[model samples]
Target chain A: MWAFTLRRLLYAVPVLLGVSMLVFALIHLAPGDVVDILVPPEVPKEIADSLRQRFHLDEQLYVQYVAWLGRLMVGDFGVSFFTGRPVAEELFGALGNTLVLALPAAVLGFLLGIALGALAAYNHGTWLDKLFSATAIIGVSLPHYWVGIVLVAIFAVVLNLLPAQGMGFEGLPTSWEHVQHLVLPVVTLSLIPMGVISRLVRANVLEILSQEFVGTLHAKGLFSRRVLYHTLKNAAPSALALMGLQFGYLLGGSILVETVFNWPGSGGLMNLAIFRRDVPVLSATIVVLAAIFVVINILVDVLQALLDPRMRR
Target chain B: MSQVLANLPRATEPVVSVEDLHVRFLLREATVAAINGVSFDLEAGQVLGILGESGSGKSVTLRSLMRLLPPARTRTEGRIRIAGHEITAMDETALRHVRGAKVAMIFQEPMVALDPVFTIGVQIAETIVRHEGISYSAANQRALELLEMVQIPSAARRLKSYPHEMSGGMRQRAMIALALSCRPTVLLADEPTTALDVTVQIQIILLLRQLQQELGMAVIFVTHDVGVAIEVADRIAVMYAGRFVEVGPTEKVIDTPAHPYTAALLTSTVLGSTFGRRLEAIPGTPPDLRALPAGCSFAPRCRHAQDRCRVHMPPEAVLAPGRITRCVRVADGELDLGSPNLSERSIAKP
Candidate 1:
C-alpha cells in the first residue's frame, strides 16, 4: 500500500510540470503582458522597459518558463501586477476560502448522489427510480447560477431568512451568520456533482446487480441488507473515482456561482485577475487548481486499489 | 396428511421432492414455458443427474427447488419440499433460512458465482454464520475446514484470497466449499464443472462424489456432459424441451436409452469405448418453448420420429419396472429399444 501511494505520487511529477508549462504558455500566448495593462500610455519608454524587465518580460519565452518554474518549486508565485501584493499570500487566503466552500458542497453533493443512486438502482424500473432519476437530471441541467439568484431573492430580499452571499468576512464559517452565508453558494455549487455522481452510481450498481455473483449471493441465503453490502463494496471503486472527478469540478470553483454569491474564493480572485490581466495570479491559480485535481485523482486511485485488489497492478 | 407422514418409512422418505413443477418466465414481450410439468423425488444420500442441452429447463428445475427464480418476472406452479421445508409455500424470510441451511447450490460459472471483491473465506463464512447463527470466528474456522475438505492447497492462505486470485478450478472448489458449509441435505449443482477444463472437470467430479457420500447429502446434479452424469449419478434424467423424456437407473439408461434424444446424446459424446465409431449429432434444434407443437417435444430431432410422434404427446410409460420412458411407439410396446435385464424394482413413480 505504501508502494502504491509512492508510485502514484511519483506519477504526478510530470503531470504537475505539464500543467505549469501550459499555464506559462497560456499567459505568454495572450495579447498583452502584465506591463501593457499596468503601464499607462503617458509612461516613458524607459519606465515601461524597466517594468517589463522586472517581470521577466525582457527574456525569451523558454527562459521565462524556466524562471517561473524555478520560483514555483520554491513556493514563490511572484506578485499581482495590479496591487503589487504577493500572489501566494493573496491566493492562499482565497484558496482556503474555496476549500471551505468546496469541501462542504462536495460532501453534500456526493453523499446525496450515493444515497439517491443506491435507491434508484435498488428500485430499478419503478416509479421511485424514475422520480430520483428525473430529480438528478434536473439538478444537473438547471442553470445553477440562476438558481442562486432566485435563492438570494427569496432568502435575502423577500423572506429575509438568511444571508444570501459571501462567507461572512472569509476565513471559515465560525458562527451561524457565517454558516448562513455559505448556504446558497454551497447548494448552488453542489448541483452538478449530485447529478453526475448519482447517474454514475446508478449505472454502476445496476451493472453489479446483473452479474452472476448476485445470484451466488442470493443462493448463499444472505439477507437483503447483507446482499446490498456486497453490492455496495463492488460498486465502490468506480463510484469513488467519479466522486473524485466531480469533487475536482467542485474545487475548480464555478466562477458564475461564486460571483452570484459574492464569495471571495479562488473563482472570484481568478475573475479579477482575468479582467485586470494580473498574469502572475492568473497563471498561479490555474497551476494550483490543476495540481489539486491531479492530487485528488491520485488519492482516488490509491483508495480504489485498496478497495479492489485486482487494480493494484 | 399427518397420518400419511407418520406411515411413511422415515428412513426412505426423499430429501427433495417436486410435484407437477412448472416454470414460466413472464417477460413483457412473451410468456416462456421454461419448465413444463416436471416431477422428481430424490431420496437421502442418492445422486440424481439431470442431463440436457442448454434451455432444456434442467437449470430451471434445480433453481425452482429452492425458489431461486426471479419472483417479479417468474410464474411458478408446483410444490417443492427440501429437507422437510416446503419451498413453494415459504415466504422470503422463511426461504432464506432454509436456502443455505437445508438446501444449497453450486452455480455453473465459478468465476461469476463467487463474489469477486470479497475473500473466499468471508463468502463461505458468512453463509455458515447466517444459517447456523454461529460466531464469526467459528464460521471462519469451519470455512477453513471446508476449504481443506474440497482440497484447496494451503487452505489457510487461500481463504484470504479473493475469487479473482484463484484459478478456475480453485474458484469452483471454493464454490463447493461454500455450498457444503451448512451441511445442506440437498445440493443443487447447475453445471458446476462446465466451465472447467477436462482435467479439472474430473477432479471436481471426483471431489463432489466423495463429499456427497461422506456427508450423505442428497444431490440433484445438472449437467450437459454424459460422462459426468454417468460417473456421478445413480439415476439419470434425460430432459428435452422442459420435460424428462427418459429417466431410469444410470446404468440401464446409458446402456439402453429408450428415447431417441438420450440415445443421440450418448452417441454424440466422446465417452469411453465409443472412440472409433463415427458419432451422430441430434438433428435440428430444441422445440420453441413459447409455441411448442402439440406433440412429442423431441419429434423434430428424433431419428425414429414417426407420423404419430408429431400428432400427439406421448404419456409416460414403464420401460421395465423401475424405469420410465415417453414415446408413442414405446407406449404400444412396439419399440424394442433394448432387451431387459433382471427387474428388481426399488423405485416407482410417485
Candidate 2:
C-alpha cells in the first residue's frame, strides 16, 4: 500500500510540471505585462527601463522562464509585482482562507449529496426519487456565479438577514461570523458539484444494488440495513472517484465562487492579479492550483485502485 | 399434517414446499408471468434439480421463496412453506431472517456473486455475524473453516485477498463457502456452475454434491444441463415456460419422460445418444411470456401439440409411480411416445 501511494505521488510530479509549463507559456504569451500595467503613462523611458530591468522584464522569454523555474525549485515563487512580497507568502495566506471556505463547502456538499443520492436510489422511480433528481438537475444546471448573485440578492437585499458580501471584519470572532458570511457563497459553489456527485452516486448505487452479490447478501438473511450498507460500501469506490475529481475541480473552480462572495482567498487574489496583469502572481497561483488538482486526482485514482483491486492491473 | 411431520425424517420437516407458485414481473407496459402454478416439495438433504431453458422461471421461483423478488414491480403468488411456515405472507424482516439462516442462495455467476470491495474472508465472516450473531473473530474463524470446506487453498492467506485476486473456480468456491457459512437448511444453487468453464463446471457440481451430502442440506440445484441434473439431483423437476412440465425421480424422469418437453430435453442431451449425427437444438425459443398462448404454455414448442392442447392448459397427470407430467395428450394417449416417428411432414408442420 505504501509502495502504491508513493508511486502515485511520484507520478504526479511530471503531471504538475507539465500543467504548470503550459499555463506559464499561455500567461507569458498573452499581450501586456506587469510593467506595462503598473507604469504611469507620464513616466520617462529611462525610469521604465530601470523598472523593467529590476523585475527582469528586459530579459528574453526563455531566460525569464528559466530564472523563474530556478527560483521555483528553491521554494520561491518570486515577489508579487504589486504586493512587493514573496508570492508564496501571499499564496499560503490566501490558500488558508480559500480552504477555510472550500473545505466546509466540500464536506457539506459531499454529506448532503451522498445521503440524497442514496435515498433517491433506494426509492428509485418514486416521487421522492423524482423530487431529488429534479432538484439535482436544476442545481447542476444553474451557473455558480448566477446562483451566488441570486443568493446574495435574496438574503442580503430582500431579507436583509446577513451581510451582502466580503469576509468578516477585523475585530469580530470569525468562526460563527465567518460561517454566516460563508453560507451563501459556499451553498452557491457547492450546489452544482453536489448535484453532480449525488447523481453519479445514485446511478452507481442503483447499479450496485442490482448486482448478484447484493442478491447473495439478501439470501444470506442479513438485515435489510446490513445489505444496503454493504452494497453502498462496495459501491463507494465509484462515488469516491467522483468525489476525488470534484475535490480537485472545487480547488480551482472555487476562484469564481470566492470572487462573487468577495472572499479573501487565492481565487480572489488571482482575480486581482489578472486585472493588474501581475504575471508572476497569476502564473504562480495557476501553477499551484494546477499542481494541487493533479495531486488530488492522482490520490483519488490510487485510493480507488487500492480500495477496488479490479483496477490494479 | 402434524402426524405427517411426526412420521417424517428427523431433519426439521421438508425445509420448503412451494405450492401453486406464480410469479409475474411487470416490465414497462407489459406483465410477464414467469412462474405459473408451479408446485414442488423439497425434502431436507435432498438435492432437487430444476432443469429448463433461460426463461423457464427456475430462478424466479427460487427467488420468490425468499421474497427477494425486486420490490413492488414483481408479484409472487404462492404458498411457500419453509418448515411448515408460510414464507409468502411473512414481512420483510421475518423473510430476511428466513433467507440466510434457514434458506440461502448461491447465484449463477461466481465472480459476480461476491462483492468486489470486501476480502473473501470478510464477506463470509459477514454472513456468520449476520445470521449467527457471533463475534468478528469467531465469525472469521468459522469463515476460514468454510473456506477449507470449499477447498479454497491457503484459506488463511486468501482471507485478505479481494474477489478479483482469485480465479473463477476459487471465486465460485468462495461464494459457496459464504453461503454455507450461514448453515442454511435449504441451499438454492441457481445454475451455480453455469458461468464456469466446462472443466471447472464439473468440479463445482461434484463439490456441491459432496457438500450437500456432508451438510445434509436440501439443495435446489437449478440448471439447464440435463447431464448435471442427473449427476447431482436425486429428483428432477423439468420446467418449461415457467411451469413444471414434468417432475419425478432423476432416473425415472430421464428414462421415461412423460411430458413432451421433458422428452425433447432428454433427447437433446448428447450424454447417452447412440447415434453420432450432428447435435439437435430446441427448435425455437420459449414463447414470449407477455403474449402467451391461451392454453398450455409449451404448446408452441411441443411436437405432440394437438387441438385440445391449444384450448386448455395441461392438467397434472400421474403417468407412472412417482412420475408427474403436465400434458393433455399424454393422459388420453393422443400422443404416442414409444417410437416418435418424426418424418419430414410432422417436423415442419409445427
Candidate 3:
C-alpha cells in the first residue's frame, strides 16, 4: 500500500510540471505585460524598458520558464510584480484564507450531501425523495455568484442578520466572529458541490441497495438502518472519489464566488492578478492550486484502495 | 446445545407449511402471476427439493417464504408458517426476528450474496450480534466457530478475508455457515449450487445434506436440475408454470411420474438410453404470466392435452398416501404408466 502511494506521488511529478508549463505559456501568450500595467501610459520608453529589465520580462520565454522552474525547485516563488513581496509569502497567506473557507465548506457539503442522499434513498419513490431530488437539481443549476447576491439581499440587506462579505473584522480573530463572516461565502461556494455530491451519493446508495448482498443483509435480520449502513460502506469508495473531485473543483472554481463575497482567498487574489497582469503571482497560484489538486487525487486513490480491498492491488 | 434444543417446540410439528401461495408482480403494463396456488409441508430434518425450469416461479415461491419481495410492486396471497409462527401475518419487527433465527435463506450466487467490502467474519458476527445482542468480541469468536463448522480450511485466516478474495466454492461455504449461524429450523436454499462447477455442486449437495442431518433443520432446496434434486431431496415437488404438477417421495416421483410434465422431464435427461439419442427438449416455452389461459397453463406443452384438458384446469389429485399430482389425464386412466426405463433411471441417480 505504501508502495502504491509512493508510485502515485512519483507519477504526479511530471503532471505538475506539465500543468505549470501550460499555465506559464498561456499567461505569457495573453496580449499584455506587467510592465505596461505598472508604468503609466504617459511614462517614457526608457522607464518602461528599465522596469521590464528589472523583472526579467526582457528575457526569452524559455529562459524565463527555466529560471522560474529552477527557483521553484529550491522552494522559491520569486517576488510579486505588484507588491514586491516574496510570492511565496503572498501565496501562502492567500492559500490559508482559501483553506479557511474551502475546508469547512467541503466538510459541511460532504456531510449534508451524504445525509440528504441517504434520506433520499431510504425514502425512495416518496415525496421526500422527490423533494430532495428537486432541491439537488435546483442547487446545481443556481450559479454561486447569484446565490451569493440573493443571500446578501435576504440576510444582510433585508433581515439584518449575519454579515455578507469579507473574512472578519480586521482586529477580531475570535472564532465566533469569524464564523459570522464565513456563512454567506461558504454557502455560496458549497452549493454546487453539495448538489453534485448528494446526487452522486444518492445514485450510488440506490444502486447498492439493490445489490444481492443487501438482500442477504435483509435475510440476516438486520434492521433497515443497519442495512443502509452496510450499503453506505459498500458505496463509500465511489462517494469518496466524488467528494475528492468536488473538493478540487471547489478550490479552483471559487474565484467568482470569492469575487462576489469579497473573500480574501487565493481565488480572489488570482482574480486581481489576472486583471493587473501580475505574472509571477498568477503563475505561482496556478501551480500551487494544481499541486493541491494532484495531492488530493492521490489521497483519494489511497482512500479508495483502503476502503475496498479489491482495489488494494 | 441441549438447552437450546429443549427450548424448541415439539419435533413432530412440520418445520414449514405453506397454503395456496400466490405471488403476482405488478408491472406498469401487466400483472405477472409468478406463483399460483402452491402448497407444501416439511418436517424437521427433511429436505424437499423444488424442481422447475427458468420462470417456473421456483425462486418466487422461496423468496415469498421470507416476504423478501418488494412490497409496492408485488402482491402475495398465502399463509406461510415457519416453526409454528404465522409469518404471513407477522409485522415487520416480528418478521425481523423470525428471519435468520427461525428461518434463514442462502442464495445461488455466493459472491453477490456476501457484501464485497466486509470481511466474511464481520458479516457473520454481525448477524449473530443483531439477533443475540452479544458483545463484539464474543460475536467474533462465534464467527470463527461458524466458519470452522462449515469445514472451511484455514478458518481462522479466512475470517479476515473479503468475499472477493475467496474462491466461489469457499464463498458458498462461508454463506452456508452464515445461514446456519442462528440454528434456524428452516433453511431456504435457492439454487445454492447452480452457479458452481459440477464437482463443486456435488460437494455442496453432500455438505448440505450432512449439515441438515447434523443440525436437524428442515431444508427447502430449489433447483432446476432434476439430477441435483434427486441427489439432495428426500421428497420432490416438480413445478410447472407457477404450480406443482407432481409431488411425492423421490423414488415414487422418479420411478412412476403421474404428471405428464414430470414424465417428459425424466425422458429429457442425458442419462441411460437417452444419453446417445437426441435429447427430447420440452416442446414450447412457458406460458406468459400476463395472458395465461383460463384452463391448465401447461396444456399447450403437454403431449396428451385433449379438448377438455384445454377447457378446464386439472384438480390436484391424491394418488395413494403422501403423493399428489395435478393432471386430469392421471384420473382418466388413459395416461401411460409404464415404468421409467430403469437403465436410464439408475444412470441418472447420483
Q: Please give each candidate's TM-score.
A: 0.94, 0.93, 0.94
What is the DockQ for all candidates, taken in turn? 0.77, 0.80, 0.84
lDDT of 1 by residue, B1-350 (tens): 11222253556578888888889999888889999888888877778999999999999998888787878889999888888888899889988898888889999999988888889999999999898899999999999999999999999999999998999999999999999999999899999999999999999999999898788788889999888898889889999888989989888888878887877787677662243445557678888899888899888877788898998788888867658788868667677655222122112212
What shift in Å separates residue A149 of candidate 1 from its native position after superposition?
Answer: 2.6
What tens digits encode model 1's per-residue C-alpha lDDT throughout A1-313?
8898899999999989888988889788988656767878898989999988778789999999998899999999998898899999989998888889899999999999989999999999999999989989999999999989998999889999888766776577778877888888888888888998899899999999999899888888899999999999999999999988988877777789888988878888998999999988999999999999999999999999988988987
True contacts kept of each: 0.75, 0.95, 0.84
What is the per-residue lDDT of model 2 for residues B79-194, given as tens digits with 9 covering 90 to 100?
Answer: 99986567988888888777778888888887888888889998889878887788999999998999999998899999988888899999999989988887888898898888
Worst ten in a row by lDDT for model 3 chain B: B1-10
Candidate 3 lDDT over B1-350, as tens digits, reads: 22333355756768799999999999989999999899988877778999988899999999999999888899999899999889899999999999998899999999999999989999999999999999889999999999988889999999999999999999999999999988999999999999999999988888998888788888899998988888888889999889998899887888888988888887787641344455578898889988888788889998888888888778888987769988888866788755555665445655
Q: Model 3: runs farther than 4 Å from truth?
A: A41-46, A170-177, B1-11, B342-350
- Residue A248 of candidate 1: its Cα lDDT? 82
lDDT of 3 by residue, A174-263 (tens): 688778898888887778777888898889888988889988998999998898778888889998988888888777747888888887
Error of 3 at B85 (Å): 1.6
Model 3 whole-model lDDT (C-alpha atoms): 0.87
